[model samples]
Every structure is written in structure tokens, then in C-alpha cells.
Target: MSDKINWEYIKEFNDSIRTIWMPFGLPEIIDPSHSRFSNGVDIQPAWKIPPKIAISTTITGAMFSSRGNPNHPMTLEEISKSAREACEAGSPIVHIHVRDENGYNVLDPEKFHKVIDPLKRDFPDTVFDGCMCALDSAEWPHMESFLKEGLLEVTPINTVAVLYGDTLFAKPPYSMIEKTKICQDCGVKPQIAIYTDADVDNADRFLIKPGLLQKPYHWIILAAVPGCSPMQNPRQMVEGLMRTYNNIMDIDDTASVMVCAAGRASSYLATFAMLMGLHIRVGMEDTVWKWPHKDDKIVNNAEHFKLFKTMAGMLGREVMTPDEYRRMIGLPVRKK
Candidate 1:
């Protein structure tokens, strides 16, 4: 079983990723503001994030709050501020969700620059992985326009998978082809996020799309979600990922994938994901700890990191620092 797992192969890949995101100098610490949807509670303090977390070819981290509310709705005003806080907290790359004046999630054409402009000015150092919500009635042309004009660094998500099977995009602003072309034209990497082992087919369809995917793509596994089926068996889950990765590698040896598990099952899935040489995304984005079960309700950010750390240690995986992350992601170094 140990030989079958390919621990050495996985470790070599882990080391390469670490070398890419080597450790770097710490980022600035700033004051945090209200989280508007925090039920009106104050935002988590700036002191909450450590000075720096991990390193690769450059030191880097996936910056986030210990108690960030996954259930919280983000506004442009709120997201703009929230994103800045993450930047100040030493996150070079920030995953974003745009919100509106009334705090509803809207994708109005006029609102794009409202968040991007000011954010670029204040936190120029941070790389923004801008997003357009699939929940909203967003289309491909709109996605195309966002990439061409928004000047966003990366798009952490895309509607390509949603486009293949759903009839929901039978209207303007939702053309599947143009959205994909814009991404290729813009050279933004798509983070393939899936709900179940079967959903890996979504990624398969992505490869067939014209010019949507080039060689050497990145993928993410999203476990145990509502619309997506549940993965209760750890053995099946891990094995599927390995096989899926092998299949992707058959297409392109440079293919990469990661996991972002949901619910209480996240901790174990996260560990398994990392043990296999994958990146991580842990925050309030996926689950709310307000549920009754102690792990079900809200657990703090440190606990998640501790879990990640423990699993990585047991598996002989070294965490990537901020500097390492920058090189891996190809972000330019900050001038001192």
C-alpha cells in the first residue's frame, strides 16, 4: 500500500512547489473595519493573521481570518475593504467576491470598476484573483469584458463547467464561447472546482472546449456540497483524485490540482489533499461554523491551519511561505 501511494513522487512535486514559493519579507499590518454582513459585528482584527506563514521559490501564504464567516455575504464596499485587510495581513493573492450598495450580490456592468479601481490604488502590491459569481446571471461576453478591461491578475473561478450542462445561460452576457476566448486572450488561469468525484467530468469537458484550456492546467476538488453529491468515504475520495490526476497528466504531465473540502469533512479531506501535493484554500467561503456540531458550527482559522500543518508534517510535506508562493504564481517581487 505504501509503495502504491507513490509517496516519493508526491514529495518531489511538493518540494518543487515549495521551491517556487520560497519565503519572503513580511507584509504591512493595518487596521480592519466592519464586515457589513458580520450581522453588523466588527471585522476580525488585523493582528489575527501572523506576520508570515510559509515559503516556496518565494515565501508566501494563503492569507485569511481565523473566524472569517463563510456564510457572510460580501458587498463591493465590503469586499473592497475586506480584500485590503487580507492584503495588509500579508496575502499576495486574494480571492474576491463583489457586492453591491444594499449588500446584495449583483453583477451590474457599471459596478466592475467600482471595486477594481480603488482596490488597485490602495493595495497595489497584492495580486487579485477576481471572480464573477456563477450564482448571478453572468454570461461569457460579460466575463470576456471583465478580463479585457478589469486588469485582474487571475480568475479563481469560471462558468465553463456550468456552461456545458446547464440551459440556464440561454441569454445575453452568458455566451460560453466568448467567455472562454477572453480568458485565453487574457492568459488567466482557471481554477477547476468540482463538487464530487463524478464532477471530474466537468473538467474533461473543459478540455474539449475550443481554446478554453491550454496544456498544464490547475484543478481544485470541492467536497461534500449541497448541489453536488457527498463523498463520505475517505478511501474512495483520495483514490479518485489520484486517478483523476493521472488522467489529466496523460493529457499534460504538468497538470496540477488541489482540494477545498466543505463542511466538517473538510479537515480530513484537506489533509489528504495536501499529503498528495496540492494547494489549499481554508476560510469562511465554504462553510459556516454556526451549525450545532462543534466542528459543524464555527471553528477558528488557526484550528484549520493547525490541522493542515499536522497533516503535512505527518506526511512530510513542508508548508509554502509567502515568497515561495509568489514565484509559483509568478507575481513580481515587491520593492523594499
Candidate 2:
């Protein structure tokens, strides 16, 4: 009895396995009605929307300087020129991190105005947003002034503290809430910067669930940045992004997710986001290299936009226009 095989038990087990594996029975064609077709009563799923991607170019950020790229825009004129080039390359959203005469990232209203005012005059339909600068109290006044002057149409609010090397970029719950209120009060849209999944939870608990952040929430899922939540492995980074995105969608189904990175992996992450019907942000702020493994540097923000446009074309997705992006993100289209 111990040596003999139990053929009856083996057959039963095999049948059970097959039943579990093929619950619906071997890929038979189903009725169109049984498909995800919108019935008369139920709302159509968001995936039904055609593939259109908003390309947001971060013209400059805390990373790049004269040290990284000799042509990295440091002056007002240079920054303005870079931003204009980005728009010409079909980026509807231009993200700025205004640098002073010394190239240090600052949130000065006047400094920002110098770069933005001219761009606004030229690309009236383009949306402008900027880095909030480490979530410091001293920076809030400048940010508020910038918003009040209508220089910025969108701004980021980091949800948690992140260590970019030894420096801690802190965003306490109280400060983040305050920042959200400021954005709301100033009529500027706030996009939450998520460095990790914890940041997403923090955003939900502090900004979202409390009714501070309303429907159709916007998010920037940041990854591959050093000293924060770096996912250097491509597979892990994609999986991490998927999880982070799912976490956000779990909380708010209507939330718009954008993917970005701080290294050579930026382009890949952006591509993945586009394939998933999400948005993308790319520029010198995220990466200076044209390719992940190559040393070929991106000479300007326009280059990033051009490459992103080509990728979008290859993916069968349209690059969204400035006014189209504005409407999608709930911003008013600017009049020329």
C-alpha cells in the first residue's frame, strides 16, 4: 500500500488543478455586451479614453548647474530661452526651478517672474509650475507671492521628508497642509510629489481624505533619485511605480499620475507611464544624459521634448497641446 501510486487521487488532483487554471474554460469568444462596453446606466471606465499624453518639461531643477552642463541655464535670459525651446519642442507644461545669479535654486517671486513673465507673453497657453524648494517656512512667503502674481499655474507639495544625500528635504504634515491651502487660495493647482509609497499615504491622510485635495488629484511619482527611494533595478523600479500608482488609484480613481526619475532611468520610466495611459515629465531636471547607458548629454530641454514626442508617436499616443493639457488638469486655458 505504501509503495503503490494512488492513480485515483492523482487524477482527482489533476482535474482540480485544471478547473482552477481554466475557470472560464479556454479563451472562448464572449459577447460584445459581456466585454467592457459601456452600458446605458454605468459610467465608462477611464481606460476608454484615447491615448493622449501631457509632456511636462522641467527646464531646470536643483540637480543641474554649470558643473553638470556648461549650458545649463543659470541666468534669467538663459532660463527663459531654455523654457521657450521646451515649448517649441511641444511640451505644454514647463516646470521651472528658478536659479539666482549664482545658480542656486531659489523661490524668489521676482526672480521667477523674470523668467515666467516673458514666457507667458510668448506661450500664453503653456502651463508653468516650479519646485517649492525643500518645504521650508521661509520659502512659503515667496511661493505665495509668486502664486498671487499669477506667475505659476501649478506647484508641487512634497508629502514627506526625503533625504537627497545628507540633506533632508522635509515636508511635515502641517507644512504640507499649509502648502495645499496656499495653492488652493491662490487659484494654483497643487501636484503632490511622491518619493515613496509612504508619501502617497501621507498625501491621502493629510491632504486628500481631509478634503483639502479635491477630485481628480494630480501626482508626480518620483523614483531612481539618490538618497530617497532609489529603484536602480529597472524591473523593481517599474514594479514600484506600478504599486505606487495603484496605491494612489485605490484612494482616488480619478487621480492623474505622472512618472519621473532623477537619472538615466528617467526616459524609461516616462515611457512606461505613457504606455500605462499616465502622464510624463522629462528634462535636464531629471536627467542630463540622452540615453540610460550612453554619455551623450541632452543639450537642452527641447531635446528631451523631441525624444519624448518620438516615443509617443511610436506608442500610438498623441502629445497633448497646452490648452488640451490645461483642460485635462482642470486649469483654465490662457488666452493669447
Summarize candidate 1's per-residue lDDT along 193-291 as a digit string, tens digits: 555544455445544344465544666655544443354567655675566556555655655565664554555656566655666665445555423
lDDT of 2 by residue, 1-336 (tens): 665988777777764555434335225444433433334533333455447888899887876677777767778888889998987776889999888777888887778778888888887787888877544668767777787777888888888777865577777788889878888888888899998788999998998888988656889987777665666768876888888888988997787878874565667778778888888888888766666667777787888788888988898889888788777777878666
Q: What is the TM-score of each candidate against the true structure?
A: 0.60, 0.83
Task: Mark the regions of model 1 whose C-alpha exceeds 4 Å error after superposition.
Answer: 1-73, 101-104, 109-112, 133-141, 156-177, 205-212, 233-240, 243-247, 290-293, 296-336
Candidate 2 — which residues are off by over 4 angstroms? Answer: 1-49, 134-137
Q: Residue 255's C-alpha lDDT in candidate 2?
A: 77
For every candidate, C-alpha RMSD to the true structure in Å: 18.4, 6.4
lDDT of 1: 0.50
Model 2 scores worst on lDDT over the 10 consecutive residues at 25-34
Model 1 weakest lDDT span, ten residues long: 55-64
Give the clashing pairs for model 2. none
- Residue-pair clashes per prediction, in order, are 40, 0
